[model samples]
Target: MRIALIGQPNCGKSTLFNQVAGYKAETGNFTGTTVTFTESSVRVGGETIEVVDLPGTYTLAGTNPAEREASRYLLSEDVDLIINVLDASHVAQGLELTIELLAMKAPVIVAMNMMDEAARIGIKIDGPALQEKLGVPVMPLVASRGRGVKPLFLAALRMGKKKNPDTSNYLKIKENDRMARHRLAGELEREFVKRGDRRVSKRDRLDDFLLHPFWGYIGLIVILYTFFQIVYGLGVLIETPLLAFLETITSQAATYLGEGKLFTEIVIGALQGVIAGLGIVLPYLVPFLLGLGLLEDIGYMSRVAFLMDALMHRIGLHGKAIVPFILGYGCNVPAVMSTRTLDDPKERFVAAALATLVPCAAILSVVFGLVAFYLGPLIALILYLLNIFIIALVGRVLTAMIPEDTPGLILEIPPYRIPTPRTVVQKAWFRIKEFLVEAWPLLIAGSAILALANYFHAADFFNTLFRPITWTLGLPSATGVPLIFGIFRKELSLVMLGQALGSMSFDTVFTSVQMITFTVFVMFYIPCLATLGALRRELGTKDMFSITGLTVVIAMITALLARGVAMIFF
Candidate 1:
């Protein structure tokens, strides 16, 4: 039997699915369409069943892609049973969707999630009473804590076992009966819900500060600054000792190998790649991802979108663009993939292009390792601010050129709560793991290839080929190989630069102007191959190429401009 999980956005549907299915899930494409749903298998009552977590939709009538996907799946008769996860705190609003789901001619078990939050707001739902009224099983759950999840799915499996189960007995309302259904939902809510004395809810109390126009922006800036300080400071504390240990091992290996042999170069390259991947990148990446995951788990991310709405509109996009923009800082691949959440094609395209330009953690490692260490954190922070300006400028141009009647932000501002440690750690680990898996092999391979080229006296061939652009940016022709390798993985450029120059102390080989120019070039250059693939998947090949061509031009132009300014000034 096939089971479907459906719910409104921010309704804990995903949390419930993850708890029931663990980490074993895949994105399944819809029949003959690009739309995708999460597919997983779960064992209930010693029988394995196919379970699909459908996209979150408030109603079957919604015209959005996610809603359309859910609506189409329900109409396809593919699902034998449905677990309609609902927010217990907002039952009256949630019941509207429940009423529509009931008319779908499938057996449904309502999983009333977030019961603890609801009770805190003085709501007491009589589950059995709701079950009787709806003619379907109602299970109370707190999905975050895994409370009642197993029993909930077990109840769903029992409901699925019945032959041609009837759900049409519910109110018999048409799907288009929006107002009537809402009124009916309110009546049902009154019947099943008992309200105690109203008290100031935590969400409301927190929103007073987080949602304030003046203080909210202040809070956001301060949070971001603190995030950077924590990540950078922790990176300093960890990277020094860690790199020192790795450097010692590499020095011993160098001593053993006794220099200029071809095989020796390969061994050194391999060791340096391993050192750069584990020793340099992991320190910042772990803390940065953990912090991002914490913010997302606590629901501050949505508030960020809400706060940025006005500024986003100025760029001809909505607040929703903030998600991919911020996510791009961690890694551009997922950031580009996340553009699928935007409803408009133009918005998605524009957002994806802009997101690709954001300096990800890989690039952050470069800035922290090379620029911040050689110059100062203040200058490094200035480069970040300049990058933001560039993104805004590019975004504004894209918005103007591809003008559309884009809708404003209609995001759900979920309640602020303490982040679950398990969820945060899992999320952070997943992102960090992606970095290690994708970048390490490429790093090792690229490092060996470059090392071999140097050993074979062919390194100067690439230098001559890229000399025109390299000279224009006031960087040595030798920096060309690292810039090219950056397309494989951004951080690889920094690691390879050390190998290419035979020194990790960048200050010895590069002037301040050349260092800044190279950083700018890397910052705006073509995205890594993984990000390119994600772009092809999210946007099409045509847009991907366009983004690639555009960034190449942007990076070159920006680098030349930086070089010129540096020559004119200091």
Candidate 2:
């Protein structure tokens, strides 16, 4: 049997999905669209079932890709039952989608998620009354804390087994248009939910400080600074000992195998790539993702969007663009995919382009591994600030050239919840698994390929091809191949640089100026292979080429400026 999970954005549908699916779900696109959904096989009530978590949509008939995707999948004959997740605090809006889903005549059950948030504001929901009104089971749940999870799935399981479900009364109400559903939703809310003595909660008061005009920006800076320190500190603790441990093994093996032989070089080179992913990339990446997950789970991310909305306007973007930027820090593929959420095509293009400039976690590994690991955290932080300044300038220029009149940001600010360790770890692992599965293999293969090129004396060709560019930047010509390969995987560039320079300890071969300039260039250059595919699907082939060219120009200009500045100081 199959169950489909559906809800509007910020309605806790995804949280509920994660509660049950955990890290076992696989994310992919539907058969014909670029729109993505998650699915996992789970056993409930002694029966294994497939649960599909569709993209968040406000209405079935909406024009956006996600909305259309949701509508198509829900209407398909394959869905046995529909689990409509509703945000308990936002009763009316949740019912808007619920009424429409019921119209399809699928076996439907309502999962009222985030019930604690509803109660904290003194809002009372009669679940039994709602179930009576909708003519379907309504399950109360707190997904983050795992409350009522088993009962909810068990209810869904039992309902799935019934050939004739109890949803006939809901099917009687005609849900023809958006306005009709909207009205019906409001009517249902009036009958079922009671608003009592409202309390001003601590989260509401905390937002006063977090969303303040002046103090908010200061807090953003401090929070970001502290985040970097925690990740870097954790990375150092692991990376130092891990790299030291690998160095001993690889060195002893090199002497045993005889350093210059082809077989020996291939084995050591491939192992070094594995070493880089384990010792270099993962040290910073694991903690970075974990910290990022905590920020997102606790809901400070929305406050950031609210605070930055004004400043974003100056750059011809809105606070909503911050969504892609935040995700970009984790990986650019999802960041590019997120641009689809915007209504305006021009805004999507502009946001997608600028998001590429936001260094991804792989490029982040390059930053911390090289800059923070060697130069110190202060300079690394400065480099990040400089990258942001460059992105804002590029946004302003792109918006000026496009010259579109776009709408202001209309976004929901989800109430803050105390994060659970289990939820946070699941979120982090979900993201980090992509690195281990996709990029780690490429890192190993690319390292071995570069080793073969070196053993065969073919590295000179790539270096010569990139000679003019490297000569212009006053960097060694041999640095060219790594930069070219960065278009494949950004972290590969860092690893290959270690190979080209004959040391994973970068400071041994390059001066402070060389390292800073090389990193700046890598930070802003072409998007990786996966991100390029996402951009093509989102903005078309022409814009992909345009954005790729734009990044190259931005990279060259920024690197030269950094090179000049570093030379004077160093």
Candidate 3:
């Protein structure tokens, strides 16, 4: 039997899935983690049942890809039961989605989740009363704590065995009739909800400082700065040892090659490429993924989205754009995919395009190497700030150019909690495993291809071919090679850059202005292969080409502009 878990953002659907499936899935307080549907299996009464957890969405009627996906799957996919998880404290908001699900005439068992949070907030729910009114079974649950989950599952199993319930009364009403629905909802609330004395809310204290218009922005800056600081510190601590180890292996391989041309090509070209690129990247990726997983599992990311919503709206993006930007710090493919939550096409396009401008893991790795080795921490911070400035600038410009009616941001801010170690490790392992499976093969293949290019001098040929454009941007001719390779994979840019420069320390070879120009060109150059694929899927070929063409032109112009300004000032 197949069961689907559906709910609005932050309603504990993912948590419920994890409990029932007896495995870990990425559950975040934010809307983005569950953007993609995930499937798992559980044994009930000796029968294996498959459960699919769809992305948390607001309303099925919206254009948001996540919402659309949820709606489509629920409507079309044949399933034994629908587990509609709702937030007990925010039933009024969550009921909107439940109503839509009920309209589908499917058998649904409502799991009123987060009952503990509701009780803590002095909001009580009479589940049986609610069930009677909605004409569906309702089970109150604290999914995270594993309370009331078994009963919820039992109810789902019972409902699944029955025929689809009558739901004609649950059809979406016209806008004019919404007032009547609201009145009905209010009546239900009064009958089923009990109020209790309030204790001091933990969130209010944190939000007072973190969500203040002025201090919130300041806090965000500090948090981001600290994040980079941690990345640098962790990268340095681990990378030095790893690099030494890889160098030892490379030296041993060279000895085995024994100076023969073919052996040297394999050792210095193919082997060196993998070791240098993957080795350097792993240290940074490990720490970064771990930090991000912790932040996500602990529910801190939603607070970030909540705090940034006001500023994000100013840029014609919704608050949820924060996820893509944050994910962009890891990689742009997932960042672009996360835009499924934004309901407007124009907003999605702008968010996806601007998200590409957010420096990903490869860029962050480069920054760690360059800043720590040559420019120091202060300059590193400046480069990071430069990235944010460029993203915001692009967002503002695109906002003005696009039509005036951008989608307003309405996000659920999940409460903060300590992340479980098991949950954190599981989430991190999932990401790292995904990276290894999906990205490592590409990395390895790209490395081998680059090795062949270098062996036959194809890279040099391309470098020569693009020299004029390189000169126009005030970058060295050799940079053209890496920029071209950047389209295949972004990390390859850093690899080729390191190879062309023959050292991570480039201050001796290029002036600071030249270094900054090179970095800027690299930063804004073509999107990586994975991201390009996503763009093709999301925007289609014509629009993808337009975006790709536009990015390349903008990168070139921006590089030249930076160079010209540097020449005049310095």
Candidate 4:
């Protein structure tokens, strides 16, 4: 039996799915669309059953891609039974969707998740009463702590055994109108849910500080500052020894290869790429991805989106646009694809453009591995700040060109939960695996290709082609080739940089001003080829090229200005 898990965003649907699916879940898109869902198989009663977790949707209104995807998958009749995961603390909102699902003519088992949070708010839900009212089994679940997981799935298994379980008998008022269905949801909530004196919980007090108008932004800064500090500290601790080890090996390999042959250069160049990948994954990318996972699992990311909303408006977009920006930190491909969730085309375009500037993990590897390690975190932090300022400025310009009414933010503020180590590690690995699988082999080949190009003296041709950019930005003429390779994968730029410069160590080669300039250029240059494909898929080819052009111009200007500014300090 195939059971589909459905819920609104932050309803603990994903947490519940992960509780059962563990680390082996497979995430894939529907056959022809960018909309993704996760699926896994679980064993229950000695029978293996397939379980699919659909994208989160507020309703079956079909207003957005996620909602539409949810609508399509649920209506397809492919599912054996539906597991409607609901946030027990906020049942009324979830019930609105539930009412829509009941009319869909499928068997459903309501998994009332976050029971602990509901209790903290003094919410008393009569589970059997709700089940009786809806004519579906209602299982209380605290998925985060592994409570009620077995019973929930067992109940789902029992419900799934029936060939065609009827869900329509209880609520015969299957009103098709949206507002009327909403009213029915409220009525059901009123009947089944009770509230007593709300306990003064620590969560409430914590929110008071975290969501405080004055101190909230301060807290965000401190949180991010310390967060990066930890990532940098951990990264450097690992990087120093690893780089020394790799460098020692590279030196030995160079000696063994006897310096001047073409074959030797190619072998050493490939090794640099391999070393760069390892250096990046172990030192910077792993820690960064892990920290990002921890924050997301802890539910702090929602607060970040909320906090960034007001600032988002200044750029002529709403808080929702921040989702793409947050996703951009992991990879620009998904970030670009995620722009489909924004309501306005102009907003989507603007969000997609700005997301490309958010610096993916590859760029983070460059920033932390190179700049943060060589210059200092202070300089690196300044670069991040400047990148933000640049994004806001660019956003204002883009939105002004294609004017539209900015939508107000309508975001859910989920209760903070302690992150689970298993989920956190899984999420981190899920992202890291993308880099390892998709980008590493390319890094190796590209490095060897660059070595061959240099050996044959053809590197000069490519360097000359981009010399205008390097020259105008006050960088070494040699930086041209790496910048070009960067279009394939941002990490390749660093990999190729070692080949182009004929050394792995950057400090001995570039001045502080040169380091700042080169890094700044990489920061804003063309999105990697993968990101370009995503932009093309989402925004079309013309706009993809336009955004690509915009990035190169931004890079040249930003890098030039950075070079001048660095002259004052260093």
- The candidate that achieves the highest TM-score relative to the unseen native structure: 1
Span of 10 residues, lowest total lDDT, candidate 1: 167-176
As a TM-score, model 4 comes out at: 0.85
lDDT measured at residue 516 in model 1 versus the true structure, 0 to 100: 87
Number of colliding residue pairs in each model: 0, 0, 0, 0
Q: Who is ahead in TM-score, 3 or 4? A: 4
How do the residues 1-570 of candidate 2 rate in per-residue lDDT, one tens digit apiece? 999999988777777787778467887777766577888898887789999999989889888778988899888758889999888888999998888888785788899988987887788998898888888889999887789889999988888888877666773465478888888889888999997665677876887788777887899989877887887788768877898899899989899999899999999888877886686356776787778778877888777878889988988988877878876875676678667767788999999999999997688889998999999999999999999999999999999999978878888887887777776776667556555665566667767776787789887898899898888888988798888877765766788899777899888888899999999999999998667767887888899999999999999999999999999999
lDDT of 1 at 359: 95
Q: Candidate 1 residues 402-491, lDDT tens each? A: 878886888888888777776676666655655566556666676677668778878778888888888878787788888887786576
Q: Over the full model, what C-alpha lDDT does candidate 3 score relative to the true structure? A: 0.72
Question: Which sections of candidate 2 miss by over 4 Å?
Answer: 32-34, 164-166, 248-259, 323-349, 358-386, 403-405, 474-523, 527-545, 559-570
Model 4 spans > 4 angstroms off: 243-275, 320-345, 358-386, 437-445, 471-479, 486-519, 528-544, 560-570
lDDT of each: 0.83, 0.83, 0.72, 0.83
Model 2: number of backbone collisions: 0
Which residue pairs does candidate 4 place in steric collision? none
Per-model root-mean-square deviation over C-alphas: 3.8, 4.1, 4.7, 4.1
lDDT of 4 by residue, 1-570 (tens): 899999998887877878888578887777666567888999987889999999889989867667788888888857888999999988998998888888776788899998988887789999999999888888899998999999888888888888867665756564578798889889988999997676767777887888788788899889987876887789779988998999999989989989979999999888977886787678776887788778877878778878888899898788778767766775676677668777677888999999998887779878887799999999999999999999999999998898767667777776778887877887677667666665567667767876787789887899999998888877789988888878765866787788788887998777888889989989998998667766876788899999999998998888888999899889
Give the CA lDDT, 0 to 100, for residue 141 in model 1. 96
Question: For model 3, which pairs clash?
Answer: none
